[model samples]
Target: MPGFTLHPFTLLTASTVFMILPVTVQPAITTPINAALHAVAGPSDATDRYRALVRRLADNDPRWEVQTAAWSALISDVPTAVTDFLSPGGGYEKARARASQNASRNALVISRTISTTTATTSPIVHLTAIRASYGTLAEKDRYVRTGLKEAQDLDAKHSPVEQARQQAQQDRDYVADIALHGSGAWVRAAAQRAIQKSTDNDIQEFFKYSWASAAGCDLQAFRMNLVEQDLAYRHRLAQLIVLAQQAQHAYEQASEAAKAKAAAEARLAWSTAADTAAATQASWLANQQLAAAQAQSWQQVHDFAVTASTQQDWPTIADNAAGTSGSWSDEVAWAQSQAAEWTAVYESAKASADALPGANPTVSPSPTA
Candidate 1:
């Protein structure tokens, strides 16, 4: 009697009476959902007929509150079942999924930030490059014009060719100096563009670290523009230098022409003066010779007159000299006449000597006259 077991129906009724409605409802699972649900529902609700019975109870049971409560508890157990289901895939897969989601979100945030930063800063970078290029070009152009003006002024002032040449050389050197800067800018631009375009390790690393910084891509356009400006400036400078050189060359040639003209004029003047001097000397010499000949002819005439008068054979001399006259009186008269004519000729010679440009005439007749 002490070890006797109760009848099955009595045991069932007693179990039902003692059974408190569980707070949690068992999940009406068609099959084993997972371990958590399995503990609550047992294997009974896993079959289709049991799930139908539970549903029928939910719809028609007199104690709806208790039945709903039971079902609710069963439904609440599904979260644990889901947790159990995830177990087969391993914790690593879940961890990997979580990591992937986090990484994607972070990457999206970074991409948006970078894109926004790029959008905001790109215009500024472009503007800065443009301004730099424009400024450089302007400065270079100004210098070129200034140099050209200076060359023009110097030439206008009749500066010496050597001085002008020096100025031109200085201009050329200045252009050369600027050319280096321009060329350097161009070279740097190319280098920057290359960096931007490269797929090298260094560039990738740079991009990785430069998330909040300027990209090589942004700098390339600026560099290229600057270099273009520099080259233009250099070209302008070269043109200026050429102009200055040309001006200097023209000045030198003009100077040479002026000097040649002056020299030629001087030679012409010297030749004219020499010819005048030669003519004057020759005229003076010719005058002197003519005066000497006139004096000699007068002396010969006077000597002949004196000899005839002294001979007193003047009648015979006269007869011979006259060739058709006859008397001693006539002869005396003719001799006196001849003497007077000789004296007259001598007086005329004396007057001519006095008329000479620098003459000092001292006239005395020969004793025969």
Candidate 2:
């Protein structure tokens, strides 16, 4: 009964007082909030200071909560900025245009950095930074296109010597492939022979454009050697042909002698002579074929060298020459053996033919006489 009773008007007035008190205290609450905002979003010059502060906080801050909050604030704007820059038709185009217009200084700096740091770091890092500074992916792509265009233009402006160098490199690779792997053993051999005979100048100049090193060996020597080897093989072929002709002549003589011999013993001698001559003739034919193959191989190598020289493809000349050295020696040995074998056959045939009655066989008077 002693407690006071509240009226509706009294209750409403009490609620109003509570609301007025909050209004009066609002400034006190807002002061700290405003101060916090100002600190986080400082003046324009604050960017560098803020970055330094963030790094310091991350590196040396003792409080984990403070460090975490600093990191969060630092990265909070990254996603939004990235989205605005990357989204199609976003305001990135203006930034990209500005970047392009102002990129000269940045480009110079980047170039210098690249040149100086090339030995210490990968070039990709500089390239990536350069691309990023252009502001947007589309802008970076344009930059790349422009760079490629300039490079192509430069290549187009290349002097004849440069063009020749490129051609020489290509030619060298081609000749090397053939010399090392050609189907013809003799051609391969010829290539090797040319290499051994290369001149100093040829080696020095030709190797410049080649992928392979020549250790001061002449690449042009291969072609020249091929030509010389071809001549030698041709000479050998000519000799073989003459031997074949002589063997054929012996065969004819033996045939005639066999037909004229009436005595059984003389007939046997004539028959034996004819057989020897036939074998010799067969051997001569084989040698002629071998000689032709060898000649063809050498000729092929020579022709390749000539073509390469005409094109100024020193690499090819060099490669061909170097590739054929071993094979050339083998070819020479084989040729010598073949020559010896044929010579032996020819001598045996000649001896047998000579033992037969001279062109005139003294036929004993016919048995009827």
lDDT of 1: 0.30
Model 1 segments beyond 4 Å from truth? Answer: 1-256, 310-369
TM-score for each of the candidates? 0.16, 0.22
Tens digits of lDDT, candidate 1, 227-259:
222223222322333332333344345565475
Candidate-wise lDDT, in order: 0.30, 0.35
lDDT of candidate 1 at residue 367, scale 0 to 100: 21
lDDT (tens digit, per residue) of candidate 2 on 1-369 = 011111211111111110101011112121222122222222433234334334444443322333454455456666433223222232223333343454454455445544654322433344333333322222333445464344335445641222222333444344445446442333233334334444433323333322222211121222223222322332233333333334444455565456444233343443343343344435434434433443344344445555444345445654554444333334344445434443443344334334444433333211110
Error of model 1, residue 14, in angstroms: 99
